[model samples]
Target: MNVLINEQYDIYHVAHSGVPLLRDVKQLNPDVIIIDIESPNRDMLENLNKISQFAPKPIVVFSEQQCANTTINQMVRSGVSAYVVGEVNQKRVKSIIDIAIARFDLFQTLKQELAETKQKLSSQKSIDKAKRWLMETKQLSEIDAYHFIRKVAMDNSQKMDDVAKNILSVASIF
Candidate 1:
Protein backbone atom coordinates (compact mmCIF):
# COMPACT_ATOMS: atom_id res chain seq x y z
CA MET A 1 0.00 0.00 0.00
CA ASN A 2 2.86 2.36 0.81
CA VAL A 3 4.41 1.86 -2.62
CA LEU A 4 1.22 2.98 -4.32
CA ILE A 5 0.76 6.07 -2.12
CA ASN A 6 3.05 8.57 -3.76
CA GLU A 7 2.62 11.86 -5.71
CA GLN A 8 -0.13 10.38 -7.86
CA TYR A 9 -2.44 9.72 -4.91
CA ASP A 10 -1.99 9.61 -1.17
CA ILE A 11 -4.07 7.59 1.24
CA TYR A 12 -6.70 9.76 2.90
CA HIS A 13 -7.17 7.46 5.90
CA VAL A 14 -6.28 3.95 6.97
CA ALA A 15 -8.55 1.64 8.98
CA HIS A 16 -8.55 -2.00 9.93
CA SER A 17 -12.03 -3.26 10.77
CA GLY A 18 -13.67 -6.42 12.00
CA VAL A 19 -16.93 -4.46 12.07
CA PRO A 20 -18.16 -0.86 11.76
CA LEU A 21 -16.08 -0.40 8.62
CA LEU A 22 -19.08 1.23 6.93
CA ARG A 23 -19.17 3.99 9.55
CA ASP A 24 -15.54 4.88 8.90
CA VAL A 25 -16.00 4.90 5.14
CA LYS A 26 -19.02 7.21 5.40
CA GLN A 27 -17.00 9.64 7.47
CA LEU A 28 -13.92 9.50 5.22
CA ASN A 29 -15.82 9.90 1.87
CA PRO A 30 -12.76 8.80 -0.04
CA ASP A 31 -12.91 8.55 -3.83
CA VAL A 32 -12.03 4.87 -3.81
CA ILE A 33 -11.34 2.05 -1.34
CA ILE A 34 -8.72 -0.61 -1.96
CA ILE A 35 -8.81 -3.82 0.05
CA ASP A 36 -5.90 -6.23 0.01
CA ILE A 37 -6.96 -9.60 1.37
CA GLU A 38 -5.77 -13.18 0.90
CA SER A 39 -9.34 -14.46 0.59
CA PRO A 40 -12.51 -12.89 1.94
CA ASN A 41 -14.58 -14.94 4.36
CA ARG A 42 -18.39 -14.97 4.49
CA ASP A 43 -18.44 -12.39 7.28
CA MET A 44 -16.27 -10.03 5.23
CA LEU A 45 -18.48 -10.41 2.16
CA GLU A 46 -21.61 -9.71 4.24
CA ASN A 47 -19.99 -6.59 5.68
CA LEU A 48 -19.18 -5.37 2.19
CA ASN A 49 -22.83 -5.87 1.16
CA LYS A 50 -24.04 -3.81 4.08
CA ILE A 51 -21.53 -1.05 3.31
CA SER A 52 -22.73 -0.90 -0.29
CA GLN A 53 -26.30 -0.16 0.76
CA PHE A 54 -25.49 2.81 3.01
CA ALA A 55 -22.11 4.22 1.91
CA PRO A 56 -21.64 3.45 -1.75
CA LYS A 57 -18.28 4.15 -3.39
CA PRO A 58 -15.83 2.56 -5.76
CA ILE A 59 -14.21 -0.52 -4.15
CA VAL A 60 -11.22 -2.39 -5.49
CA VAL A 61 -10.27 -5.72 -3.94
CA PHE A 62 -6.94 -7.41 -4.59
CA SER A 63 -7.15 -11.06 -3.59
CA GLU A 64 -4.10 -13.31 -3.51
CA GLN A 65 -6.11 -16.49 -4.11
CA GLN A 66 -8.00 -17.21 -7.32
CA CYS A 67 -11.64 -16.58 -6.45
CA ALA A 68 -14.42 -19.03 -7.19
CA ASN A 69 -17.40 -18.09 -9.43
CA THR A 70 -19.72 -17.76 -6.43
CA THR A 71 -17.19 -15.64 -4.58
CA ILE A 72 -16.87 -13.26 -7.50
CA ASN A 73 -20.66 -12.99 -7.91
CA GLN A 74 -21.15 -12.33 -4.19
CA MET A 75 -18.46 -9.66 -4.15
CA VAL A 76 -20.02 -7.92 -7.17
CA ARG A 77 -23.46 -8.07 -5.58
CA SER A 78 -21.93 -6.73 -2.36
CA GLY A 79 -20.58 -3.68 -4.27
CA VAL A 80 -16.94 -4.52 -4.92
CA SER A 81 -16.58 -2.88 -8.35
CA ALA A 82 -13.15 -4.15 -9.30
CA TYR A 83 -12.07 -7.56 -7.97
CA VAL A 84 -8.59 -8.50 -9.20
CA VAL A 85 -7.29 -11.96 -8.33
CA GLY A 86 -3.56 -11.24 -8.36
CA GLU A 87 -0.76 -9.25 -6.75
CA VAL A 88 -0.68 -5.47 -6.83
CA ASN A 89 2.15 -3.15 -7.71
CA GLN A 90 2.77 0.58 -7.59
CA LYS A 91 2.53 0.96 -11.39
CA ARG A 92 -0.75 -1.00 -11.56
CA VAL A 93 -2.52 0.83 -8.75
CA LYS A 94 -3.49 3.96 -10.71
CA SER A 95 -4.91 1.93 -13.62
CA ILE A 96 -6.90 -0.26 -11.25
CA ILE A 97 -8.37 2.81 -9.53
CA ASP A 98 -9.42 4.30 -12.87
CA ILE A 99 -11.08 1.05 -13.95
CA ALA A 100 -12.88 0.70 -10.65
CA ILE A 101 -14.24 4.25 -10.81
CA ALA A 102 -15.46 3.73 -14.40
CA ARG A 103 -17.22 0.48 -13.54
CA PHE A 104 -18.85 2.01 -10.49
CA ASP A 105 -20.12 4.96 -12.52
CA LEU A 106 -21.62 2.60 -15.08
CA PHE A 107 -23.37 0.62 -12.39
CA GLN A 108 -24.79 3.80 -10.86
CA THR A 109 -26.14 4.97 -14.21
CA LEU A 110 -27.87 1.64 -14.81
CA LYS A 111 -29.38 1.66 -11.35
CA GLN A 112 -30.76 5.17 -11.82
CA GLU A 113 -32.35 4.25 -15.15
CA LEU A 114 -34.01 1.21 -13.65
CA ALA A 115 -35.43 3.28 -10.81
CA GLU A 116 -36.81 5.85 -13.22
CA THR A 117 -38.48 3.17 -15.31
CA LYS A 118 -40.14 1.65 -12.27
CA GLN A 119 -41.40 5.02 -11.08
CA LYS A 120 -42.92 5.74 -14.48
CA LEU A 121 -44.64 2.38 -14.51
CA SER A 122 -46.05 2.94 -11.02
CA SER A 123 -47.31 6.40 -11.92
CA GLN A 124 -48.96 5.06 -15.04
CA LYS A 125 -50.70 2.33 -13.07
CA SER A 126 -52.09 4.85 -10.59
CA ILE A 127 -53.25 7.16 -13.37
CA ASP A 128 -55.01 4.23 -15.07
CA LYS A 129 -56.75 3.26 -11.87
CA ALA A 130 -57.95 6.84 -11.35
CA LYS A 131 -59.19 7.01 -14.96
CA ARG A 132 -61.16 3.82 -14.47
CA TRP A 133 -62.68 5.13 -11.22
CA LEU A 134 -63.84 8.32 -12.94
CA MET A 135 -65.25 6.41 -15.90
CA GLU A 136 -67.34 4.20 -13.66
CA THR A 137 -68.40 6.69 -10.94
CA LYS A 138 -68.86 9.87 -12.99
CA GLN A 139 -70.32 8.10 -16.09
CA LEU A 140 -67.66 9.77 -18.24
CA SER A 141 -65.87 8.34 -21.28
CA GLU A 142 -62.27 7.21 -20.82
CA ILE A 143 -60.84 10.16 -22.77
CA ASP A 144 -62.98 12.66 -20.85
CA ALA A 145 -61.95 11.10 -17.57
CA TYR A 146 -58.30 11.47 -18.53
CA HIS A 147 -58.84 15.09 -19.55
CA PHE A 148 -60.61 15.87 -16.27
CA ILE A 149 -57.76 14.41 -14.27
CA ARG A 150 -55.22 16.37 -16.28
CA LYS A 151 -57.16 19.60 -15.79
CA VAL A 152 -57.41 19.03 -12.04
CA ALA A 153 -53.66 18.35 -11.86
CA MET A 154 -52.82 21.48 -13.86
CA ASP A 155 -55.16 23.67 -11.84
CA ASN A 156 -53.86 22.43 -8.51
CA SER A 157 -50.19 22.59 -9.60
CA GLN A 158 -49.75 18.95 -8.59
CA LYS A 159 -48.23 16.00 -10.38
CA MET A 160 -50.60 13.76 -12.36
CA ASP A 161 -49.84 10.85 -10.07
CA ASP A 162 -50.69 12.89 -6.97
CA VAL A 163 -53.97 14.01 -8.54
CA ALA A 164 -54.73 10.44 -9.49
CA LYS A 165 -54.09 9.29 -5.92
CA ASN A 166 -56.39 11.99 -4.59
CA ILE A 167 -59.16 10.92 -6.94
CA LEU A 168 -58.73 7.29 -5.93
CA SER A 169 -58.85 8.16 -2.22
CA VAL A 170 -62.05 10.24 -2.60
CA ALA A 171 -63.72 7.54 -4.72
CA SER A 172 -62.85 4.81 -2.21
CA ILE A 173 -64.67 6.67 0.61
CA PHE A 174 -67.97 6.15 -1.20
Candidate 2:
Protein backbone atom coordinates (compact mmCIF):
# COMPACT_ATOMS: atom_id res chain seq x y z
CA MET A 1 0.00 0.00 0.00
CA ASN A 2 2.85 2.39 0.84
CA VAL A 3 4.62 1.59 -2.40
CA LEU A 4 1.39 1.86 -4.38
CA ILE A 5 0.71 5.32 -3.00
CA ASN A 6 4.31 6.31 -3.46
CA GLU A 7 4.06 5.20 -7.06
CA GLN A 8 1.17 7.68 -7.50
CA TYR A 9 -1.62 5.09 -7.48
CA ASP A 10 -3.78 7.02 -4.95
CA ILE A 11 -4.51 4.03 -2.75
CA TYR A 12 -7.22 5.14 -0.41
CA HIS A 13 -7.22 2.48 2.28
CA VAL A 14 -5.67 -0.82 3.34
CA ALA A 15 -8.64 -3.02 4.12
CA HIS A 16 -8.84 -6.33 5.96
CA SER A 17 -11.36 -9.13 5.83
CA GLY A 18 -14.57 -9.00 7.98
CA VAL A 19 -14.75 -5.43 6.72
CA PRO A 20 -16.50 -4.09 3.63
CA LEU A 21 -13.49 -3.97 1.31
CA LEU A 22 -15.65 -3.53 -1.75
CA ARG A 23 -17.67 -0.72 -0.27
CA ASP A 24 -14.57 1.02 0.96
CA VAL A 25 -12.95 0.75 -2.47
CA LYS A 26 -16.01 2.20 -4.18
CA GLN A 27 -16.13 5.10 -1.73
CA LEU A 28 -12.39 5.70 -1.81
CA ASN A 29 -12.11 5.25 -5.60
CA PRO A 30 -8.67 3.71 -5.68
CA ASP A 31 -6.63 3.23 -8.84
CA VAL A 32 -5.42 -0.27 -7.93
CA ILE A 33 -6.01 -3.06 -5.41
CA ILE A 34 -3.77 -5.68 -3.80
CA ILE A 35 -5.37 -8.60 -1.99
CA ASP A 36 -3.69 -11.13 0.29
CA ILE A 37 -6.29 -13.87 0.45
CA GLU A 38 -5.92 -17.39 1.73
CA SER A 39 -8.25 -18.55 -1.05
CA PRO A 40 -10.05 -17.10 -4.03
CA ASN A 41 -13.00 -14.89 -3.14
CA ARG A 42 -15.67 -14.84 -5.85
CA ASP A 43 -17.50 -11.97 -4.16
CA MET A 44 -14.43 -9.79 -4.34
CA LEU A 45 -14.08 -10.42 -8.06
CA GLU A 46 -17.77 -9.70 -8.68
CA ASN A 47 -17.57 -6.48 -6.74
CA LEU A 48 -14.43 -5.55 -8.65
CA ASN A 49 -16.16 -6.16 -11.98
CA LYS A 50 -19.08 -4.03 -10.86
CA ILE A 51 -16.79 -1.21 -9.89
CA SER A 52 -14.58 -1.69 -12.95
CA GLN A 53 -17.34 -1.64 -15.50
CA PHE A 54 -17.54 2.13 -15.20
CA ALA A 55 -14.02 2.87 -13.95
CA PRO A 56 -11.43 0.16 -14.50
CA LYS A 57 -8.29 -0.22 -12.42
CA PRO A 58 -5.57 -2.75 -11.65
CA ILE A 59 -6.13 -5.59 -9.18
CA VAL A 60 -3.48 -7.82 -7.65
CA VAL A 61 -4.05 -10.99 -5.67
CA PHE A 62 -1.54 -12.92 -3.55
CA SER A 63 -2.69 -16.31 -2.33
CA GLU A 64 -1.24 -19.31 -0.56
CA GLN A 65 -2.75 -21.85 -2.98
CA GLN A 66 -1.03 -24.01 -5.54
CA CYS A 67 0.18 -22.23 -8.68
CA ALA A 68 -1.91 -23.79 -11.42
CA ASN A 69 -2.67 -22.49 -14.90
CA THR A 70 -6.41 -22.88 -14.53
CA THR A 71 -6.45 -20.86 -11.32
CA ILE A 72 -4.29 -18.14 -12.86
CA ASN A 73 -6.60 -17.87 -15.85
CA GLN A 74 -9.60 -17.69 -13.59
CA MET A 75 -8.10 -14.97 -11.43
CA VAL A 76 -7.09 -12.86 -14.44
CA ARG A 77 -10.52 -13.18 -16.01
CA SER A 78 -11.94 -12.25 -12.63
CA GLY A 79 -9.79 -9.07 -12.59
CA VAL A 80 -6.62 -9.56 -10.56
CA SER A 81 -2.89 -9.18 -10.76
CA ALA A 82 -0.68 -12.23 -11.13
CA TYR A 83 -1.80 -14.86 -8.67
CA VAL A 84 1.47 -15.40 -6.84
CA VAL A 85 0.81 -18.61 -4.97
CA GLY A 86 2.92 -20.53 -2.39
CA GLU A 87 5.84 -19.19 -0.32
CA VAL A 88 5.76 -15.55 0.66
CA ASN A 89 8.60 -13.37 -0.48
CA GLN A 90 8.12 -9.85 0.82
CA LYS A 91 10.49 -8.33 -1.71
CA ARG A 92 9.01 -10.32 -4.57
CA VAL A 93 5.52 -9.31 -3.58
CA LYS A 94 6.47 -5.66 -3.61
CA SER A 95 8.23 -6.07 -6.94
CA ILE A 96 5.22 -7.80 -8.46
CA ILE A 97 2.94 -5.01 -7.30
CA ASP A 98 5.20 -2.41 -8.84
CA ILE A 99 5.33 -4.32 -12.12
CA ALA A 100 1.60 -4.91 -12.19
CA ILE A 101 0.80 -1.24 -11.63
CA ALA A 102 3.33 -0.16 -14.22
CA ARG A 103 2.02 -2.69 -16.72
CA PHE A 104 -1.59 -1.62 -16.19
CA ASP A 105 -0.67 2.00 -16.63
CA LEU A 106 1.21 1.27 -19.84
CA PHE A 107 -1.60 -0.91 -21.21
CA GLN A 108 -4.12 1.88 -20.71
CA THR A 109 -1.87 4.47 -22.34
CA LEU A 110 -1.11 2.21 -25.29
CA LYS A 111 -4.78 1.44 -25.81
CA GLN A 112 -5.69 5.12 -25.96
CA GLU A 113 -2.79 5.95 -28.23
CA LEU A 114 -3.56 3.08 -30.56
CA ALA A 115 -7.22 4.07 -30.73
CA GLU A 116 -6.32 7.62 -31.65
CA THR A 117 -3.90 6.49 -34.29
CA LYS A 118 -6.48 4.14 -35.79
CA GLN A 119 -9.05 6.91 -35.92
CA LYS A 120 -6.65 9.19 -37.72
CA LEU A 121 -5.74 6.47 -40.18
CA SER A 122 -9.35 5.66 -40.82
CA SER A 123 -10.17 9.30 -41.39
CA GLN A 124 -7.23 9.72 -43.74
CA LYS A 125 -8.39 6.74 -45.76
CA SER A 126 -11.88 8.18 -46.07
CA ILE A 127 -10.52 11.56 -47.10
CA ASP A 128 -8.36 9.98 -49.78
CA LYS A 129 -11.31 8.00 -51.09
CA ALA A 130 -13.44 11.12 -51.20
CA LYS A 131 -10.76 13.04 -53.06
CA ARG A 132 -10.46 10.23 -55.60
CA TRP A 133 -14.19 10.35 -56.17
CA LEU A 134 -14.12 14.09 -56.86
CA MET A 135 -11.14 13.72 -59.19
CA GLU A 136 -12.88 11.05 -61.27
CA THR A 137 -16.22 12.89 -61.44
CA LYS A 138 -14.79 16.37 -62.11
CA GLN A 139 -11.89 15.15 -64.29
CA LEU A 140 -9.62 17.21 -61.97
CA SER A 141 -6.03 16.38 -61.15
CA GLU A 142 -5.22 14.82 -57.75
CA ILE A 143 -3.47 17.98 -56.54
CA ASP A 144 -6.40 20.15 -57.54
CA ALA A 145 -8.91 17.89 -55.81
CA TYR A 146 -6.80 17.86 -52.64
CA HIS A 147 -6.51 21.67 -52.61
CA PHE A 148 -10.24 21.95 -53.24
CA ILE A 149 -10.96 19.71 -50.24
CA ARG A 150 -8.50 21.66 -48.11
CA LYS A 151 -10.14 24.95 -49.06
CA VAL A 152 -13.54 23.61 -48.06
CA ALA A 153 -12.18 22.30 -44.77
CA MET A 154 -10.68 25.70 -43.91
CA ASP A 155 -13.74 27.63 -45.09
CA ASN A 156 -16.03 25.61 -42.82
CA SER A 157 -13.50 25.64 -39.94
CA GLN A 158 -14.00 21.88 -39.78
CA LYS A 159 -11.53 19.04 -39.79
CA MET A 160 -10.39 17.67 -43.15
CA ASP A 161 -11.70 14.27 -42.04
CA ASP A 162 -15.16 15.65 -41.34
CA VAL A 163 -15.24 17.36 -44.73
CA ALA A 164 -13.98 14.19 -46.35
CA LYS A 165 -16.63 12.11 -44.61
CA ASN A 166 -19.30 14.50 -45.91
CA ILE A 167 -17.89 14.18 -49.40
CA LEU A 168 -17.92 10.41 -49.16
CA SER A 169 -21.50 10.38 -47.94
CA VAL A 170 -22.65 12.63 -50.76
CA ALA A 171 -20.75 10.68 -53.41
CA SER A 172 -22.07 7.37 -52.10
CA ILE A 173 -25.66 8.59 -52.47
CA PHE A 174 -25.14 9.34 -56.17
Candidate 3:
Protein backbone atom coordinates (compact mmCIF):
# COMPACT_ATOMS: atom_id res chain seq x y z
CA MET A 1 0.00 0.00 0.00
CA ASN A 2 2.79 2.38 0.90
CA VAL A 3 4.63 1.59 -2.31
CA LEU A 4 1.57 2.37 -4.44
CA ILE A 5 0.74 5.56 -2.52
CA ASN A 6 4.30 6.82 -2.19
CA GLU A 7 4.79 6.59 -5.92
CA GLN A 8 2.15 9.21 -6.66
CA TYR A 9 1.47 11.17 -3.46
CA ASP A 10 3.28 12.19 -0.33
CA ILE A 11 2.25 10.39 2.84
CA TYR A 12 1.00 12.36 5.81
CA HIS A 13 0.42 11.02 9.31
CA VAL A 14 -0.38 7.33 9.54
CA ALA A 15 -2.47 6.01 12.43
CA HIS A 16 -2.34 2.41 13.57
CA SER A 17 -5.61 3.01 15.45
CA GLY A 18 -8.65 5.22 14.98
CA VAL A 19 -8.65 6.63 18.53
CA PRO A 20 -7.02 9.93 17.62
CA LEU A 21 -8.51 10.21 14.14
CA LEU A 22 -10.21 13.54 14.62
CA ARG A 23 -7.33 15.14 16.53
CA ASP A 24 -4.79 14.03 13.96
CA VAL A 25 -6.97 15.21 11.11
CA LYS A 26 -7.44 18.60 12.71
CA GLN A 27 -3.72 18.99 13.28
CA LEU A 28 -2.54 17.62 9.95
CA ASN A 29 -5.17 19.27 7.78
CA PRO A 30 -4.37 16.91 4.97
CA ASP A 31 -5.95 17.40 1.57
CA VAL A 32 -6.99 13.77 1.51
CA ILE A 33 -7.12 10.89 4.03
CA ILE A 34 -6.49 7.24 3.25
CA ILE A 35 -7.28 4.56 5.84
CA ASP A 36 -6.18 0.97 5.58
CA ILE A 37 -8.05 -1.20 8.04
CA GLU A 38 -9.13 -4.80 8.39
CA SER A 39 -12.63 -3.64 9.23
CA PRO A 40 -14.36 -0.51 10.45
CA ASN A 41 -15.72 -0.57 13.97
CA ARG A 42 -18.49 1.58 15.48
CA ASP A 43 -15.99 3.92 17.12
CA MET A 44 -14.12 4.38 13.88
CA LEU A 45 -17.31 5.27 12.04
CA GLU A 46 -18.24 7.72 14.78
CA ASN A 47 -14.85 9.37 14.50
CA LEU A 48 -15.24 9.57 10.76
CA ASN A 49 -18.64 11.20 11.18
CA LYS A 50 -17.15 13.74 13.57
CA ILE A 51 -14.40 14.49 11.06
CA SER A 52 -17.01 14.95 8.36
CA GLN A 53 -18.95 17.42 10.47
CA PHE A 54 -15.99 19.35 11.89
CA ALA A 55 -13.28 19.15 9.21
CA PRO A 56 -14.31 17.78 5.87
CA LYS A 57 -11.79 16.08 3.57
CA PRO A 58 -11.81 13.40 0.92
CA ILE A 59 -11.49 9.97 2.56
CA VAL A 60 -10.59 6.68 0.91
CA VAL A 61 -10.74 3.45 2.89
CA PHE A 62 -9.13 0.20 1.86
CA SER A 63 -10.38 -2.69 3.97
CA GLU A 64 -9.73 -6.39 3.81
CA GLN A 65 -13.02 -7.21 5.55
CA GLN A 66 -16.17 -7.33 3.48
CA CYS A 67 -18.76 -4.91 4.84
CA ALA A 68 -22.51 -5.20 4.81
CA ASN A 69 -24.66 -2.96 2.63
CA THR A 70 -25.84 -1.00 5.66
CA THR A 71 -22.27 -0.48 6.77
CA ILE A 72 -21.32 0.84 3.35
CA ASN A 73 -24.32 3.18 3.43
CA GLN A 74 -23.30 4.41 6.86
CA MET A 75 -19.78 5.05 5.61
CA VAL A 76 -21.06 7.06 2.66
CA ARG A 77 -23.41 9.08 4.87
CA SER A 78 -20.51 9.67 7.23
CA GLY A 79 -18.66 11.33 4.31
CA VAL A 80 -16.35 8.61 3.14
CA SER A 81 -15.51 9.23 -0.49
CA ALA A 82 -14.43 5.72 -1.39
CA TYR A 83 -14.54 2.26 0.31
CA VAL A 84 -12.77 -0.63 -1.29
CA VAL A 85 -12.87 -4.21 0.00
CA GLY A 86 -10.34 -7.04 -0.50
CA GLU A 87 -6.75 -6.68 -1.58
CA VAL A 88 -5.71 -3.33 -3.03
CA ASN A 89 -4.39 -3.28 -6.55
CA GLN A 90 -1.30 -1.10 -6.91
CA LYS A 91 -2.40 0.17 -10.31
CA ARG A 92 -5.86 1.26 -9.15
CA VAL A 93 -4.80 3.16 -6.04
CA LYS A 94 -4.20 6.47 -7.78
CA SER A 95 -7.46 6.29 -9.69
CA ILE A 96 -9.35 5.45 -6.52
CA ILE A 97 -7.90 8.47 -4.76
CA ASP A 98 -8.73 10.70 -7.75
CA ILE A 99 -12.30 9.48 -7.81
CA ALA A 100 -12.64 10.05 -4.05
CA ILE A 101 -11.44 13.63 -4.41
CA ALA A 102 -13.88 14.27 -7.25
CA ARG A 103 -16.78 12.78 -5.33
CA PHE A 104 -15.96 14.81 -2.20
CA ASP A 105 -15.77 18.02 -4.23
CA LEU A 106 -19.11 17.37 -5.85
CA PHE A 107 -20.78 16.57 -2.52
CA GLN A 108 -19.45 19.76 -0.93
CA THR A 109 -20.74 21.82 -3.85
CA LEU A 110 -24.18 20.29 -3.54
CA LYS A 111 -24.25 20.77 0.22
CA GLN A 112 -23.36 24.46 -0.13
CA GLU A 113 -26.03 24.97 -2.77
CA LEU A 114 -28.64 23.34 -0.55
CA ALA A 115 -27.74 25.55 2.40
CA GLU A 116 -27.93 28.68 0.27
CA THR A 117 -31.28 27.64 -1.11
CA LYS A 118 -32.65 27.04 2.38
CA GLN A 119 -31.47 30.48 3.52
CA LYS A 120 -33.14 32.11 0.50
CA LEU A 121 -36.36 30.27 1.21
CA SER A 122 -36.29 31.36 4.85
CA SER A 123 -35.71 34.98 3.85
CA GLN A 124 -38.50 34.84 1.31
CA LYS A 125 -40.88 33.49 3.95
CA SER A 126 -39.96 36.33 6.31
CA ILE A 127 -40.45 38.92 3.56
CA ASP A 128 -43.81 37.45 2.67
CA LYS A 129 -44.91 37.46 6.29
CA ALA A 130 -43.86 41.08 6.71
CA LYS A 131 -45.74 42.02 3.54
CA ARG A 132 -48.87 40.30 4.84
CA TRP A 133 -48.59 42.18 8.13
CA LEU A 134 -48.34 45.49 6.29
CA MET A 135 -51.33 44.63 4.13
CA GLU A 136 -53.50 43.72 7.16
CA THR A 137 -52.47 46.43 9.65
CA LYS A 138 -51.43 49.38 7.46
CA GLN A 139 -54.25 48.78 4.94
CA LEU A 140 -51.69 48.73 2.13
CA SER A 141 -51.90 46.61 -1.00
CA GLU A 142 -49.42 43.77 -1.49
CA ILE A 143 -47.62 45.65 -4.24
CA ASP A 144 -47.48 48.80 -2.12
CA ALA A 145 -46.05 46.91 0.88
CA TYR A 146 -43.44 45.22 -1.26
CA HIS A 147 -42.43 48.54 -2.80
CA PHE A 148 -42.23 50.14 0.63
CA ILE A 149 -39.93 47.42 1.88
CA ARG A 150 -37.79 47.57 -1.25
CA LYS A 151 -37.50 51.35 -1.00
CA VAL A 152 -36.49 51.16 2.65
CA ALA A 153 -33.88 48.48 1.87
CA MET A 154 -32.44 50.54 -0.99
CA ASP A 155 -32.33 53.75 1.09
CA ASN A 156 -30.52 52.07 4.00
CA SER A 157 -28.43 49.78 1.78
CA GLN A 158 -29.71 46.83 3.77
CA LYS A 159 -31.12 43.53 2.64
CA MET A 160 -34.85 43.35 1.98
CA ASP A 161 -35.08 40.51 4.47
CA ASP A 162 -33.49 42.66 7.16
CA VAL A 163 -35.95 45.47 6.45
CA ALA A 164 -38.75 42.96 6.60
CA LYS A 165 -37.51 41.67 9.96
CA ASN A 166 -37.45 45.20 11.33
CA ILE A 167 -40.97 45.78 10.10
CA LEU A 168 -42.15 42.63 11.83
CA SER A 169 -40.41 43.62 15.04
CA VAL A 170 -42.11 47.04 14.99
CA ALA A 171 -45.44 45.41 14.23
CA SER A 172 -45.06 43.07 17.19
CA ILE A 173 -44.75 46.05 19.54
CA PHE A 174 -48.24 47.28 18.61
Query: All candidates' lDDT scores?
Result: 0.61, 0.61, 0.61
After superposition, candidate 2 runs with Cα above 4 Å error: 1-42, 45-87
- Compare the candidates by TM-score and give the number of the best one: 3
- TM-scores for every candidate against the unseen true structure: 0.53, 0.53, 0.54
Model 2 agreement with the true structure over 116-136: per-residue lDDT tens digits: 999999998988998899999
**What C-alpha lDDT does candidate 2 achieve relative to the native structure?**
0.61
Question: What TM-score would you give candidate 1 relative to the actual structure?
Answer: 0.53
lDDT of 3 by residue, 1-174 (tens): 242243455555464445575566556554434443333533464356464654332222333243345544544553543432334563464465544444554666888999999999999999999999999999999999999999999999999999999999998999
User: How far is 24's C-alpha from truth in model 3 (Å)?
Assistant: 19
What pairs collide in candidate 1?
none
After superposing candidate 1 on the true structure, give the runs of residues whose Cα lies further than 4 Å from its correct spot: 1-87
lDDT: the better of candidates 2 and 3: 3
In angstroms, how far off is 7's CA in candidate 1?
A: 31
lDDT string for model 1 (25-82, tens) is: 5565544455533224324633554546543322223332433455445445534444
Pairs of residues clashing in candidate 3: none
The per-residue C-alpha lDDT of model 3 at residue 157 equals: 100
Q: How far in Å is the alpha carbon of 32 misplaced in model 1?
A: 12
Clashes of 1: 0
